[model samples]
Target: MTPEFAYFLKVNVAFVLLYAFYRLFFYRDTFFKLRRTTLLAFFGVALLYPLMNIQDWIREQEPMVEVIQMYSAILPETTITPDNVPETDWHGLLLSGVSYLYWGGVLALLLRFLVQLSSILLLARKSKVMQIYDTRVHVLDRPAGPFSFFRLIFLHPGSHSDKEIDEILTHEGTHVSQWHSIDVIICELICIVCWVNPFVWLLKREVRHNLEYLADDTVLESGYDSRSYQYHLLGLSHTNKSATSLSNSFNMLHLKNRISMMNKKRSHGIGRAKYLIFIPIVGGLLIFSNIDAVARITDELVESSFAEALMPEAIQLPIQLFPAVNKEEPAEMHRGYVLSKEELAAIKRAEEQVFTVVEKMPEYPGGQKALLKYLASSVKYPESAMRNGVEGRVSCSFIVRKNGSITDAEVIRGVDPALNAEALRIINAMPEWSPGEQRGKAVNVKYTVPVSFRLANKHKASVSGTPAKGIDTSGRIFTVVERMPEFPGGQYSLLRYLSQKIKYPVIAQENGIQGRVSCSFVIGADGALSDVKVIRGVDPSLDAEAVRVIKSMPKWKPGVQNNMAVAVKYTVPVTFRLQ
Candidate 1:
């Protein structure tokens, strides 16, 4: 399941559990049904507030999406693919199920404890009863009454005064009447569930304090001397026995606060205002805790921060805009391998027959040397090519017919469109060569020829270029340049689109355009290019050219690092010069 879905499920379960507890414990007082309803309504809102506004919360924390996405990608079930692809294993699904089970078990135990405590209270109510001893002390030994439920508050034996007994009755009575035991038990459960969240634990502690305040308010309202009641509370200082599911008889904790609160004077005039304050505070909390709001705030903050970090300290504009180059087309046809001896023999016979056919062709106007001479003179080196340098290799494939005629000559490799077209033109213009023969009979055969283009020392000298030696030229420069080949149309198709868009004449030449364009871009985990930037550009025009091209290109199958698609850096060159 998605992380968001999982989170939703978890929170809903928590809310259900909390509601069940509230119904079983806090909502027992049907006399003040409206108060109970109001409390329930507040809790209901609190529980759903986070979910209803989850989108805003996500937007607020924009970076969280990346973090969550990163996490989601690592999970196995997230691998949603086409029906043609293989399905993922069930291990991830099982693990998720197990996590849900564990949390469910915890919630079950909490409910069970609350039920047991309620059972105990019922038992106490049936079996025990409160007694007044000489009016100086009221003792309930194993109180049969629910009012003295789990408590054993000591009445001052020396103070036999009726006022003191009243104070004792009012204080202990407040604890029983308000069902403080239920609050204590519920608070313990809250601590258990939210043990990892410090804020939640703090809230549980506050709930306990509030329960005490609620009981104290009851005691004072019963028409007792609040000061003497405070002294009575101080004198009764024995610590209560800690019970997992029930409130203890005596609690020494918060004694000072309770006594101080009892003494504080409250004007009846402020009651209305105090109640009014709760409306806005609670409403605001509900709004602020809204998941969508929080998410939105987080998203904006993170996106702005991330964008700022990516910007370079120094401002440098790009020189030129390069059009997005389309990816290479798969080889339309691959020459099949000869697997058997018969196949090999047949191939050999064909080669011989074709060679014989080629041998008989007439020499061209400049012969073989003439074609080479033309290539040497026509190819111009660009300035950028001079700086970064350029070398070309040509591979040609041809079929020689039985009559010694060259047929279907194709430039298989190395030759660029302009160069390849020129080479094919010259080859096509030539007379047929002597064809090969098999068993003294001419047969068609195919052959491949590789031609290397190197910058000779003299050629470099003429162009005022320094020869670069020992550089591994094969695959390095060609692979980067040819990384993405033409789509439906050839390179010119892309070039034409870019020219119109950028309004710049982008020419491909052989000699003085000097420099390199390096761009850092994100190939999204999904393999879409985004946030392209020219890290270093020699000239503004060239830089802009590179960025424009990159931005226009279609999505890539992102590079893989450790079997995962990752963002990568690419550098391409655009060389321009005179031939």
Candidate 2:
């Protein structure tokens, strides 16, 4: 699983357990402030817990064993056959589709978040503000209701009585003073990234509700009449139906629950002990996240097991000989049996022969995806092939032996010879696989894989002839072409022409500048070099000399793309030496 997707899962699991605990033990308790803090803390932990690495802790608890030595004599031989399992294209497509959908959800939610924030800012500007002491009271002339965004409070001044206004201010003031908007924004952000998890939405709702409960309690604690505040909340409920998601609103849903919670008796401090459940819950998540690595280590140790003593020595016993019999007489059978050296050797050879079929196929470390990733990263395009734009797929097959070592790799289908060699080099560098199994014994298996070599995405040069914007076209320059752009003669002659016709710069020779300077240019449809410039420079003198030589040289042919001469860009490196 990707770390990003894993993180989302971990957070949701943490939220489910943490939220469930809250509902069960502390949801109805009168510790409104504590509840708010605890909810925010839960979110903070969920976000950070996934990034922590605890593999070391897990490894420390694993049983350690001395290095095992495999004895060929003790192991029974097994047969293995390569299964032609085609790589699943749909699995890749599904994963890519899911990734796109996830990002789409994130983008949509982010856009919504920004729009909500914009609306809140717009509201602040439209409403008139009156400074009362240290607070800025934004009076919405219309019936937008009361809410707090950061330190600014928005309220419809004309819609509320003086007593109601006083209570609203105290409630929203607590939201601002306690920085409750931070919690709302935090939850909204988390919900945006983890919207796939229903528990995230539930957690956000719980947080917003807890914040409202805290604000309501703050008003009552500041000497407001409980019945009066409750009645005022009911009176405004109809008008205050909607509010910005990333702000603290004076009114929210669940007024009935809020009233009930207020009337309920306060629980003792001992109820906080319920939070202790997090200790084990978090510990379990850490173990789960790091378990895959530990399991891989354990599999390695188990797969390497070998019997301590050789099988021949363990089974060998003193043989008793029977009396010699005449040729005509039948030989008496011995009680104990022993094999001749030749027979024993033959049995050992049979046990060790590479099998053609196996019960379980060999697997690359981290599966096929990881193997592909390694190949993509490790393979380098041959310089000769790159200059000529040689591109195609290379299919190679190799043996994964019983000991998990890769061997006997050969390219079955190849493009250019240079490309084939590069492909083989990468396969040879692959790490060992989990060897194939047959009847619970490890065996050799053959595996085939395909690797493709292609040019990097090309960028358009300033020159014209680009396809019109509306028309679909292959805008990429040709790396390989029917007739490659050439110097006076052929590819081999181009190297000779550069060596004999070119002059090393005097300043470069004096300064001991000795490196290759890479230059790129477009061969126009008319077989003329345009946009000639040094792409990589060793020194100023060397770079100018490389460009000058290429400009002075004659071009005989132009690359053909789509059966027509096109402006194909090319890059070549020129070397400079003191000699």
Candidate 3:
């Protein structure tokens, strides 16, 4: 898996665990009330987010064949070739967006509910009154008696002046009125789900402190003397135990901060300034929690698995970033026919024929230069020619005629069309290759040939100009030249047929046109024209005329590669010149 994806998964698991721990121990009071609600929200977001993004994600992973089919419907038949479509990169952005929207809504709802619950608790506490004695406090315990609604004091009874009582009452009442318990509960639950994240723990602590601070500030607003209130708070420092969700009369640990805050004079309007800090902190948390970032991590992991599956045995089982490419037969290979020697030979012969034809053609400008140079030059190459440059061996099968000529050729283990067509064309144009003789007699033999299109030094040339100008010409130019194959009948007959079929200007310029019109065509196993595409147009009229004429031609003897009739790619240049 990709590192990003691994990180995402790890973070998610950690968050959930840490959150669970916090909910169980740290914030059990709030957890009991909202645990189910939080869990339901998380599950709903998870399932719905994935569903919303799956279709788009699938489209991102679509294979090349499917993309070709999609474009084929929109483009002209001749232009519906594989070269027209490109590999698409899936960034996982859409998935992330959907996930963010889902989770954001969940978080918002949870927060809103917590706020409402706090408001309700505060209202209930405000409606009651408590009588204070020297050592104990009493409330008119209702039928719901000693419940969270009634203030239950756990402090030792003590006498207090009017001012001290006012301070104590104001401070404790603030906690009840603001429903600080609810905030503590909500944060604790968040910590449970995000337990693995240290940040969640920090956030939970901050939430608790904020609740205390908010209550302390409210009490100090009641006009009690700061020094006297501080003494009252110190006197009430004895610890107390209260059940979850119950409003306790005393919290000894919080007394110091409560008294200190009351003693400090308020800076004019500091509350507004302090409140502004929430904007960036809360906004950052929301942004980080978005689903897009999570899914990107997942996609990286899946892509890494795909890459590892393609590794060779020479390397370690888990391949690294730069893995060597070698083909090992998968389980399906055992069911197929193991190719024979004769079959392999025929395929090789066909490929040789196609290569020979391409070599004989006029060299492109800066012929031995880089592919980009050849491609960028005024002279255009055909898509079929580009197929011929595909690196690797292709095995095909074909039949030999009584006159020792190759007939039907079919590609069994197919190569890319650009290279495959070149192999087929050469086989078709063979000058009576010796037919296979079985049992010491001339007999029809099935054969296969594996043609490898390796780049040799002789093919390289400078793209910009001569190598003297700092242009590198050390690589062969793999050009896709467009050309019309020499059909059985003369050019004149082909021209006449084209004029009758297509409604376009049909003219054959002189035999030696100043520039060449390179066109690419596919030669099927039956020697019929299948797809004829023009990669780069010469004169618009010339290109149209050339395409029309090339498409309107008779079939030739099929090419034989490996004793099988196979489709071949052929590139020929139609030079229009003043004779």
Candidate 4:
């Protein structure tokens, strides 16, 4: 899933679980103030918790991979056409239709929301504004809200006697004084974004209901007889038909429950303890939302508990993978010529397992800065690959053994055989690295490095004449590191933020120019971004805009090498496509 949709799912799932808990425990309680707080909290957490990265506080599971993931656009385009073109997929067409349909629903609901707001405002324009005793209200000529929007109370005063008017204003005064309308606004906004989630709508109902319960309680407490207030509410319930969707209506739905809550005895102080349960509830949501990371941790445990249990402490395999035996011979003959226990144990110790993550990652001879320079100076573009115009990233993986030697080098994913061979050749030739450790014991750790072979093109300099600050002049800036700089919320958040913040330039849009512009920048040891320059540009307008938005990004967590913060050079490809 794309980041936005993933976050949307996380938010909805979290809200559904939280609201379900609210309905079960806190819904029936008489702690009106606390329930109000709890209801509002669900909305806050449902949105914010998914954006949080708690893996560091939990446990880090990311395998340290030596990433060398740039060198694009400089390559000449290599096009190889197949004999026959494939047919178009109707699945894509169907998905496109579904996307349009979902957005149409959103647009329709937003219009409805606007209409409701305007309906209340239209009432204000038509009604007479006056002070009825001490409270300010908009008294409509037509039957409308004994309701409020923000602090503006709308009432059809002509329909009620002096006593009913007094009660209506008194009930609404609690809503205005306590700012209950804010809660209504918050719920409505959530409903719009997640229009399809039924639980969100139900949660909206609960919020409005809780607000009414609060308003009713306040009216009863302020020197009004409970019997008389209940009668006043009952009278208003069946007759008030012009309630606005965006308002806290006095004669709102669920009148029976509101009255029951009023008559219900005050809850015990001990019930407040239930509120503390939210801490764990939110904690679980945080953990589960990043379940991919958690699964890695679980897999590690399972391998130890079950898979390791089944395997012998010593690993002794026959010299040949396929043992030679006759059908008449005993099955034990195929089990192999067994080695002594000490020899088998020694072999097991020699072949200790490789880990994906550890307390500390393996380091290069000097640091990431030296590693990048070494690879850059050493890697030679293959003559065969260049002749065929084959240029793409060759993803290679290898093991850094406990003895700190590079071994088992091979290509995991590759473009051309020549390119693959060169990627592996360079990795195998790498000197010994500082081995990674888990619980103070040196262990084998795997690393993935992708070497790019983009042919240098004619676009030599940046189109935007503005030079980048702190360019890689002194070789202090690094392009590859054990851990690259991360924006606060990781890749998903970074993508979402860029998609929202970067606007297509008016000039570029009008001219119908759209292509990807690769921008490179330095993320300082302090995590501040600097030296943003276009590596390859489509247009000056596009290049400048890409730089502007990137420079506006928040500080990142600096890249680390050898357990120390370092400035790392990074590239982001921004596409300004007009649809």
Q: Per-prediction TM-score, please?
A: 0.36, 0.49, 0.32, 0.51
Ten-residue segment with the worst summed lDDT in candidate 1? 330-339
Q: Between 1 and 2, whose TM-score is larger?
A: 2
Give the alpha carbon lDDT tens digit for every residue of 337-370 in model 1: 1011111122344335333122223332444445
lDDT of 4: 0.68
Judged by lDDT, which candidate is best? 4
Tens-digit lDDT track for model 2 on 157-214? 7788778888988999989999988888898999998888887898898888888888
Model 4: ten consecutive residues of lowest lDDT: 314-323
Q: Candidate 3 residues 316-364, lDDT tens each?
A: 0111010011112111001011222233222234442311111022221
Runs of candidate 3 with Cα error greater than 4 angstroms are 1-165, 194-203, 239-241, 245-252, 265-579
Candidates in descending lDDT order? 4, 2, 1, 3
Q: What's the lDDT for all of these models?
A: 0.44, 0.64, 0.40, 0.68
State residue 32's C-alpha deviation in candidate 1, in Å.
17
lDDT at 190, model 2 = 90
lDDT of 1 at 483: 21
Q: State which candidate has the highest TM-score.
A: 4
Question: Which run of 10 residues does model 2 get worst, by summed lDDT?
Answer: 312-321
